[model samples]
Target: MKALLILLISAIITWTLALWKTTRVTSATELSSLGFGWPLQWIEQDQSRFQWASYPQDARLTFVKFDQLPAYVDWGLFAANVLIIACALLVIYFSFPLILRMFRK
Candidate 1:
């Protein structure tokens, strides 16, 4: 139960963070700045740009088309995040016992 809870929490957190990061990433520079950006970019590169209510043609009006985003982008980021987060969780789980023993000394 404890391990399940840990994996659940970690997955939720990792996936949420991945979604938030990818939603705003429109260009290579933005995605490349992230540690997981390379893999996420590798998954897809067909980001669509759009402009809404562009009376003034401001930067805010012209942005990536998040509403019409592709499925691969979302799922790709989530998959990468899950894999990375799961690996970290595994390391922590396997080493936690050794850490506790060291603190006992």
Candidate 2:
């Protein structure tokens, strides 16, 4: 149970850090009109620049399209979180009976 608790706490901390990093990076970046859902006329008027100046890179003049960008989710972090939860649940479930037996004796 102690080990499981430690594992869960570590997983939570790692996930929180990763999430914070993602949010910070995203907040610092910008998206262009290349893949925005706005109308063509609006895009032509340059209204689709979302947080264009917040990022170090200038996405406005980039030739790359938004759809070609990689996904944001970290599968490894998600898998670690799921594994930690499962281990914590298993530890609690198995330890409960042992604890009750000790109390009964």
Candidate 3:
């Protein structure tokens, strides 16, 4: 039950962060390189993004680009993320008793 709760909390957190970052899309269109890491990931727009016009008559819409697709659907990355989170939770679960013992007078 603790692991499940931890997983839910982690998912909520990452989802919140993803939404926050995505709310403000980067204006820079030039992709210098991939920035895949624990903190952030910069996959190619070509890999998981598509160009779409927000308005039919807007001139700037012609160059539309999305930096990320939804994370939930991306199974490979999502699974890896879940695995990392589960491991972290397991560590916490195992060490929690030790921590409580240390706190006792």
Best by TM-score: 3
- C-alpha local distance difference test of each model: 0.50, 0.43, 0.45
lDDT of 2 by residue, 8-101 (tens): 7756654454333321123332332222111111111122434544544433322236544333344554565556555666787799999999
Candidate 1, 1-105: lDDT as tens digits: 866776687668664554444334444443323232322332343333443332322121112555643323456566566667777888988999999999999
- Winning model by lDDT: 1
Candidate 1 segments exceeding 4 Å error: 1-7, 19-74
The reply for model 2, stretches above 4 Å from the true place, is 1-71
| Per-residue C-alpha lDDT of model 3 across residues 1-105, encoded as one tens digit per residue | 876788887666554444344222342332222233233432222312433344221111112355433222354665566667667777888999999999995
Clashes of each: 0, 0, 0
| Candidate 3 ranges with C-alpha deviation above 4 Å | 1-5, 21-27, 31-73
RMSD of 3: 8.8
TM-score of each: 0.43, 0.34, 0.44
Clashes of 3: 0
Pairing residues by index, what is the TM-score of model 1? 0.43
Clashing pairs in 2: none
**Worst 10 contiguous positions by lDDT, candidate 3:** 55-64
